[model samples]
Target: MIETNVLTITQLEHRYGGVTVLAVPFFELARGRHALLLGPSGCGKSTLLHLLGAILTAQAGRIEIDGVDLAALAPRAADDWRGRHVGLLPQQLALVSSLCVRDNVLLPAYAAGLPADEQRAQALLAGLGLADKAHAMPHQLSGGQRQRVAIARAMYTQPRLLLADEPTANLDDRACATVVALLARQARDANASLLIASHDARLVAALPGAAVLRLPARGELPCAA
Candidate 1:
């Protein structure tokens, strides 16, 4: 039987300033499965992720996650939908530098209007070896540690679908492997579908089976018509 899908996109076409960046005839991710979107930089991988994560509406095509067609929902409804089911780790890691470690991890749950549970938050941070840094600011943590904190924040709310964009760019091989494994395990335990966009082949090789989405090129300054 076909697994119920967590996210799906059909004939997606998006452009920036009239320059076509991505064109996917079809893309689908089954519930609890993981996929990797790979390509050179500027190939629209990030753009595609944004669309699926509900950060941007597809300029043309259809996108559905957890049975909800994002295009049809109002902005407020879409935000609610994302908060309840989608977890995103953007390229920047996007951690608030001013917030203490624990507070940063708990922000997602707070934003979703869910009651924050201190015990659960602590467990996640500790599991990632961040227990001691619970009060540390973002600037105080090393790059690898910062990335791990980002992962914890994403999983804190136990979302049904997780989107990670260039999550391991700053780490060394060992650190990269550790982070990848942690993410896969977390997604599996939460029964969440994970879609990661990265240029790292090592990461993709480690994932058992991950679909890849390649992007179009950035040609002559004006690009071909």
Candidate 2:
């Protein structure tokens, strides 16, 4: 059976301060599958994730997430759409250090004018082995633990699309496996499509039938971002 496209891109062009970041002519992500975007640093992998998350506006071309034309939405509308259907885990994790782990997970829904479902959030955290850390602050957790919290936060809303940048960069082989497993399971449970940008070979190897997007080296035909 042919899976419906969860994300569709055509002639996606993006620039930052006059430097072209992405010039990918075509790309598509099928629903309920996990895809790996592989490339070295400065390869525009993260930039592409950002665009998909609607964090950055495309300079040209079309971006459709779950059949909605992203480029056509107003800035506020785009942000709302992101909160509603897209979960972005940037390289930084971007957790609010001041909030407890569970609160951080619930923040997204709160921002979107949706009621927080404590049961669902707790279930996701528990599945990630973070049930005991519900009240722990971000500063209290280890790197892997913090990363898991970020993942839980992304999965809390049951988004249709999940975009992660360098999700396993800091994890060891075993930890990487654990993280990928959790992400794959959650994405499937949520009926969401996951796109991850990472340089970690182990992480890519673990994903089932992952599609790779490798970027040309710097100055190699001026590969955009």
Candidate 3:
């Protein structure tokens, strides 16, 4: 039977040198829903995001994305699957300094061995109000513009799930609100499930009604904050 959920994690655990850094008994994010993974630094929020994005394999337990088990994929197949179905917005916004905005947005398609869809890239840029900046290099854009470019890149593939890691780091209140709104709007438009990992309590209010899963610092009990 096909799975309706975009993501399902069961008994997920990751460790570094036998010290468990992240653990989740069970979690599910329904398709097209927005959820937040909230916790303090070193509480494994990033680790969880990486595991879900297939950047780091879980040391134990099961992860199913649309009913396909993550551990079942070979390395190459995992990369291709991630590129095609998972949209990642990492905190660093790792845009290629040498590539222009448009090319940067198309990078995922190239990496996935998919044809470059220039039309989709253009639409995403325009939607983010970055149409005129398409030819500009990363350095030419402001911090917020750079963030938007990263978001466009993540959304360019029209991924089934969008995962953001600390997207609001270092932003002021107004900027944070803007960024959160943009992410939500884009995710809604793309019909993709959204999962944001953050330590910011401001997000709890900014994203009212989003499912909140508060992880604990190591050795503490997990509860929603």
Candidate 4:
């Protein structure tokens, strides 16, 4: 039978310069579920996300996404796997300045060596209320619009897992709510599990019923809430 859980991690640990930065004994996110990774700025929230996204290989342990073991894949294979199975919304909103919003949303397709589906790109933008801005460059859009474009890009691959790092950072309360709502709606539409890593408390209320993993200050174990 196919596994219900889209993501699973066991005995996961990462280190930098001999310093243990993140460790999770076990964690799982079932398909279509949402979860929050809450912690202070330096508590390795981003490190965990990077590991899950396959941007960084773990020093030890296993990370399984959709029944595939990440540690078993080589660097090139891992990058391909991530492009297909994982969608990442980085805190930087790294939209390409030279590309139009539509093209920016298609970047993942090119990276994954998949055919560029302009229809899919336009549809995503429309869902995010950025249909009219598709032709506009990233610089021409507002901060929130840029974010929506990033979301569109991330969702273009219809990944089984969506990871957002500090999505609401630097946004005002109203903007934060809007961003969270957009993420929830988009993830739901894509039928993907959503995991957001952030220190923001507002998300707990914004995403009612989301599984929460609180990563304590460095050296403390992470716990579920």
lDDT of 2 at 98: 88
Summed backbone clashes in each candidate are 0, 0, 0, 0
Worst 10 residues of 4 by lDDT: 216-225
Candidate 4 C-alpha lDDT tens digits along 1-225: 664887788988788887787878888877767999999988889999998899999998999988899899999999888888889999898998999999999999888777999999999999889989989999999988998899999999998778999999988899888889889988898888889999999999988888888887884744311
Q: By TM-score, is 1 or 3 better?
A: 3
- State the RMSD for candidate 2: 1.9
| Cα lDDT listed for each candidate | 0.82, 0.82, 0.89, 0.89
Clashing pairs in 3: none
In candidate 2, position 178 carries an lDDT of 78
Q: Give the per-residue lDDT of model 2 (tens digit) for 113-216.
A: 78989888899899889999999999999988888899998987778887888878867788788778877777888888878888777766788786666654
Single out the weakest 10-residue window by summed lDDT for candidate 3.
216-225
Colliding pairs, model 1: none
Query: Candidate 4 — which residues are off by over 4 angstroms?
Result: 1-3, 219-225
Query: What is the Cα-based TM-score of model 4?
Result: 0.93
- Error of model 3, residue 22, in angstroms: 0.2
Which tens-of-lDDT digit does each residue in 45-161 have in candidate 3? 988888888888998899999888998888888888888889999989999999999999999988877899998899899999999999999999999999999999999988888
**Could you tell me the lDDT of residue 91 within candidate 2?**
89
TM-scores, all models, native as reference:
0.91, 0.92, 0.93, 0.93
Q: Distance (Å) between predicted and true CA of 201, model 2?
A: 2.8
